[model samples]
Target: MSLMLGYLEDYAKNRRGSHNYHTILVMGYAVAGKPEFALQLFGRMRYQGIDLDVFAYHVLLNALVEGNYYDGVEAVSNQIKSRGFESEVTHSILIKSFCRKKEFDRAETYLRRVMEGEVKIKGGGYIVGALVDGLCKDEQFDRAGKLVDEFGEFHVYDIWIRELVRARKLDGAMEFLHKTRNVVQYVPDLFRYNTLIIRLLRENRLEEVCDLIIEMRESNIPPDELTMNTVLCFFCKGGMVDIALRLYDSRGQIGLSLSSMAFNYLMNTLCGDGSVVDAYRILKNALEQGYFPGVPTFSVLAHALCKLEKLDMMNELFHVALENNVVLSDRIHEIYIQALCRTGRVEDGYYIHGELNRLNKVTTGCAYNSLINGFIKSNRADIAVRLLIEMQEKGHTPSRQLFRTVIQSVCETENPEKQFQRLLEMQLSLHEIDCGVFNIFIEGAGLAKKPDLANEVYQMMKRSGISPNVTSDILLLRSYLRGEKVSDGLHFFHNILERRAIGRKVFNTLIIGLCKANKPDIALSYFTNIRAKEKTVRPSLECYEELIYVLCNHKRYDKILDVIDDLIDVGRPLSSFIGNNLLLHSLKDRELYDTWVDSRPPTELTQPESSHIWRLREVVGLFSDRFRDDISIDDLEQVVRNCFPLDIYTYNMLLRKLCAKQVDDADKLFDTLCPKGYEPNQWTYETMVHGFYKHGRKDHAKLLLKEMVQRGFRPSEVTSALL
Candidate 1:
C-alpha cells in the first residue's frame, strides 16, 4: 500500500488520476487497514473537489472505527450526513464509534432515537446488531442481553452468544444456544456450536461437549474439521480411546485434520492404553499432516512401541526423529537402541548407536550393556570387548557379569590368545596397570586354559611395582589349575603361604580349582594342611562338598571317610551334595557304607543327639538292609531335608535307590519334581531313565530320554547303553 501510495502520489504530481481512480485509492487504503493514509487520501480527494460516494464513505467510517480512530469516524460521519447520503450504516458507525470510545449512553441514545423515528435511519437489524455486539465487547453483557431480548432477533441473539462464549461464559452461551435451537427453532451456525464446544472442552465439561456435538448431528449441522478434531481430543482424553481411534481412522472421510493438541492427546492416550501399534499409526499420520509431536508425547509413544517389540514401527519412528531434526532425549534413544538389540537387530542398533556418536551424545550405560551382550550373542565379542572398554572410558561401570561375558566370549574365539592379548592391551591401557586390571587379564587367560599367558600377566603385575593382593594370587593359582598345570598351581599356592597367611577364600578357590582339574591328591594335601592347624581354619562348606565329590570320583572311600571325620570335627553340617554323594556311592557299591562302618568310632556311634555322627550312621544304613524296616526312601528324603535342604542331586539319589525296590516310589518322586520347582538336569533324567528301564518300562525310559534331549541335556553313556 505504501509503495502504491508513493507511486500514485508521484503519478498525481505529474498528472492527476480520474475521480473513480482517486476514490478507489482511498477505499483501497481503508480496506487494507491503512486508515491514516486512507484519511489522508480522503482529505486530498475533498481538496481536489472529488467526494467519496456513500459506500466509500461508509467503508472509511467503519475502518476508522475499527482502528479506534473516533476523530476520523466523526469527521467521516458528518461528511456522509452533510452530503445527505446517510443510511443505517452511518448511524451504526456513529453508535459503534461511541461504544468503542466507552460512551455507552450516547450509543444507547442513538439506538432509541433511530428506533423511534426521531432519526429516520433504516437497517434496523444492522444497527441493533452492532450496538449489542459492542455492548457485549464492553462487558455490558446484561444490557446486551436486554437489547437482544428487546429486539428478539436471531441475528442479535447469535452475536450475543458469540460474545458470551468469547468471554468464557460457557454456560450462558449454551443457554442462549439452546434458546435459539428451542424457542427460535434454529441452529445458529457451525461457528456457534464449535466455539461453545471448544470452551467446554477447555473447561473439561466433557459431557456437555458431547451433548453439543450430538446436538450438531441431530440438527443436521455437519461438523467441520475443528468439530471432528475436538471430538477426537475429547474421546481420547476421556478414556474413550476406541471411539477416538475410530474417529481418527475416519479422519479423511470426516474432513478431520488433527490440531497439534489433538494429535498430542490422541497419540499419548493410545500409548497409555497399550494401543502402541495404533499410536504408531497415528504418529505416522501426524507426521504426514506436518504435526511434529512434542518431546514428551513422542517419547511416550516411542517407548511403548519399543516395549511391544514393534521394530518396524520403531525404525520408522527413529527415521522420523532423524528427518525432522527432533532431538529426542538420551533415555528415549537408549530405549530404541536396547530394544533393537533385544530383538536381534544388533547391527541396526549399532548403526543408530553411531548416530548418537555423530550427535556428540554419550550412549547410556544400559544401552552399552545391551549392545555389548547383543554383539556377544552374535559372536562379535571382539566388537563387544571394544565397546566394553569404551564404556569404561566414558565413565560407565560395566557389570562384572558383562565383563565376564566379553572375556568368556573372547576365550571362545578361534585364536583366543591373540584376541585376548589384544583385548588385554586395550584394557590395561585404559587405566593404570593396577593389580585389579592385571587380575582381569590373568582371569581371562586362566579361562582360556592359557596358564602360560596367565603367568605372564602375573609377572607383568609384579613388574609394574604393584605387589599382588590375595585376589591376584588366587586368580593366578586358579589359572594354573584351570590349565591343569597342577605342579605350577602347587608351587604358586606354597609361595602364597610363604608370603602371607591366606584366608578361607583363597584356600577354597585353590581347593575347588584343583578338584575341578581332577587333582584330588593335591587338593587333599592342602586340606590336610588346613585341618592340621592348631586352630584349623575350616574350609568353606562348598570346599568340603567339592573335595568329597572328587574323592567319590576317585573311589577313595577310605579317604572320603577321613574327610567326613575332619568335617565332623570341624563342626560343619554335612552338605546335601556330600550326604547325597555318600548315599549314591553306597547304592553303587558297598565301599562307602563299609568304610563308614569300619571307620566308625566305637563310642562315636553311641554319641548323643548333639552329635551329627548319628545322622551319618543312619545315612549309611540307607544302603544296608539293616535300616530297610526302620527307614524308607521317603523317610530318608525327609531326614535329609531336615538335615540340609535337599538339592536336586539328592532327589536324583533318592530316585536311584527307589528304582531298585519300588518303581512306584520312583514315579512318585518324579511327579513331585516339577511341583518342587526343580528343573530336571541330565543326572535327574538319567536317574529316572534308569529307574524306568530297570522296572521293564522300556517305552517310558525312551520317552524320558527324548525329553532329556529336548531339554538340551544329553543322555549319559550308561543310560544310552541301557536304552
Candidate 2:
C-alpha cells in the first residue's frame, strides 16, 4: 500500500495540474483500506490548490468511513458543506458509516438534516436503507417505517421488508407489502414477495405463504424460481409431500423454472421420511429432462440412499455426479456425515468425519454440533460431551445453543444457584452476555412476582456496563408498580426525569398511573413540569382531558382553568367535552366564571365567528340594567358607540335596544349606520319592521319590507306573520 501511494504521489508531482491523478489516488487508497493516506493525499492536493469536485470529496468521505474514523467522517462532511459541494454519495457514506458503527442517533440526525434541507444530500434508497437497518437493529421498527413514509420513497420498501423479517415481524412485513400495492408508482415486485415468503417458510407459516402466492398472482406478479422453491421447501418440511410434488409438476404452468436446489431439497426430504421410491421417480424424471443436479442435490440424494441402506443407489448417484462434473462441497460432506449418524451408523459417520478433517473441511462448529446433537438424541450424552471437548480443542467455539442445552441439563439437576453460575460462566467464556440476556431475566422475574430478583438483575446489568434503555426502565418500573412499591416507582420516575431518559410515552404512563391512583394533584404537577422543561414531550389530548375531568370532579376549578389556559397557550385546544365541562363548572360560580373568561387570551379563542357572537352577548349582558331602565336615546346611543365597534351586527343589536326605548331615534340610528357603510342585513330589516309596527307605523313597516326585498335581504318569519 505504501509503495502504491508513493508511486501515486510521484505521478501526481510529475503530472502537475491534473486533478484526476489525486482523485484516482484517493479512490485507490480508500479501496485498499488505507484511508488515512488517502486523506493525507487529499490535504496535499488542497495545499497545491487543485480543484476538487464532488467525486473527490466523495472519495475522501468514503475513505474516512472505510477506516471507521467517524469523527473524521463528520469533519469531512462539514467541509463538504463549507465548500458548497452537494454530493449524495458523501451523505450516503456518512449515513452508512454511522449506522455500521451503531451510532443510530447520529445517523438519524444527519437524515433529518438532509430532510430539512440544511444539508444538500439527495435522499435515495441506499442512505434510507442504512438508517432504516440501524433503526431496526435498535428495535425502532415503527420509527424506521415512519421514516420511509416521510421520505415517500417506495424503493426503501425492500429495506423495510428485510428489517421486519430480521426482527421476526413477518406479519408486519406482509402488511407493509400489501400496503405498497396501493402506493402510487410502487408495485410489489418479486424480490419483496420472496423476502416475505422466505421468512414465512422459516416460521412454518405455509398457509400464509400459499395465500401470499395467490395474492401475488392475482396482482399479476408471477412467482419466480425462488418463490417456487420456497413454497416447495415449506410444503416438504411440513410433511405435505404430495402438495410439494403437485407444485413441482405444475412448475411450468406457474411460470417457474425447476432449479437443482429445489429438486435436491424435495428428494432429500422424501428419502429422509421413508419415501425412497417417490424420490427415485422424481430424480429419474429430472435426469430424463436433461437437467443436471448440482453437488447439493447429489449429496442429499446420496445421503438419503445411505439412510435407506441402499449403498448401490448411493454409488450410482455418485457416478452420476461425476458424469455431470459436479464437485462435492464441504456442506455436502457434512450432510452425509449427519445422515449416517442419524441412521445409527456411528462407525461410518466417524469415518466420513476423519476424511473431511484430513481434507480440512470439518473445521466448522456446525459439523461438530450436528454430530453432537445426533449423539444426544440417540441416548449417547457421554459421546456428545467428548465431541464438544474435541470441538473446543480444535479452537472452534461450540454453538451458543450447545452451551444453553448443557446448562439446561444441569439446571434440571435442581441446583438453581449452581445453574445460574454455570450460565454466567458460559456467558463470560463466550463473551456473549449483553443487556438483552439480563432483560429476559428481569422480565421473567417480574412475571414470576419476584421484584427483588428483578432489581438485582438490573443492578447486575448496570455493573456489567450495560446502560438501561427505555425498555429496561419500563421493565423495572413495571416491577416496582406491580409490587405496590409506589415510592420506588416514583424515585425511578424522578431519575428518568433527571436524566431526561423518558420520552413522552413514559411521562404519560407515569401521569396516567398517578391519576389512576387518585393522585390528580401529583399527576398535574408532573404534566406541568414536562410541558415546561421538555419541549419534545407532547402530552396527549386524552391525558389533558382526563386530568381536567379529575380536577373538575374534585371541584378544583382554578387548577382546571390553569390547565386549560396552558393547553390553549400551546395552541392545543381542549376537546369540546372537556371545554363544556369547564364551562359548566365555571357557570356555577360567578367569580369562577369571570376568572375563566379572563384567563383566555383573545387570540386563543376558537374562531372569529363564534368569538364575535360571544363578545356581543357579553356586551349586551353588561348593558342589561341600562336596557331595562328607561334610558334616554342619547345615553343609549352614546353607550353603544363607546362600548362596541359599530359593525352591522352590533348596530343591529343596539338598534333593537333603542327601538324598545325610542322608536324615532332607532330609525335615526339605522339611517346613520347606512350612511356609514353599515348595510342592514336580514336581522336589521326585521328589527326595524317590528319596531315600526309596534309604534303604529304600519305604512313605514310596509315600505321598509319592500326596500328589504329590493336589497335582497328578507325579513324574519315573525315580521311576515305580524304583517
Worst 10 residues of 1 by lDDT: 624-633
Per-residue lDDT over 1-723 for candidate 2, one digit per residue giving the tens place of the 0 to 100 score: 678768776876788656487778777777667888777777787788864577778877877876788777877788888987855666677788887788888888987777667544455666777788778888988888888887756667778877788788987877777777666536667887788888888888888888888988888888888889778877888888888988977877897676766777798778778777678778878888887666666666666676676654554564566567665666655666666666777656666677556556554567777777776566564566567666776788765567545433333343434544445444455446777666655564555445665687788889988888777777776666555666787898888768665687787667765665567788788888777888777777777777887887776766776776566566665465564444344334444445445665665456453443344324333344312455665665554444333467666666776676578888888888867887789888898899899999999999999999999986667888999
Off by over 4 Å in 2: 1-19, 94-110, 118-130, 183-185, 273-277, 292-723
What are the TM-scores, per candidate, against the unseen true structure? 0.65, 0.39
lDDT for every model? 0.82, 0.70
The TM-score of predicted model 2 comes to 0.39
Candidate 1 C-alpha lDDT tens digits along 1-723: 567667656755665555488777777778777788889989987897888888988989989998988788888888888999888878778888888888888888888888888665446877888899888888888988888878766677778878888999988888777876788786778988788888887787878886887787788887898788887887887898998888788777666788888888888888989999888877777777777788888788888888888888888887888788887888988999899998899999999889988988899999999999999999997789889988898899887677767887888888887887788888878777788788777787788787888888788788878999988899889889999998889899889989998788788998899899898898898888776873546678899899999999898877887887778777888887788777777778876777777876688667875556677667667755456543455676876665566888888877777777777777788888999898778888888888888889999999989989999997878888888
Q: Pick the candidate with the highest lDDT.
A: 1
Query: Best TM-score goes to which candidate?
Result: 1
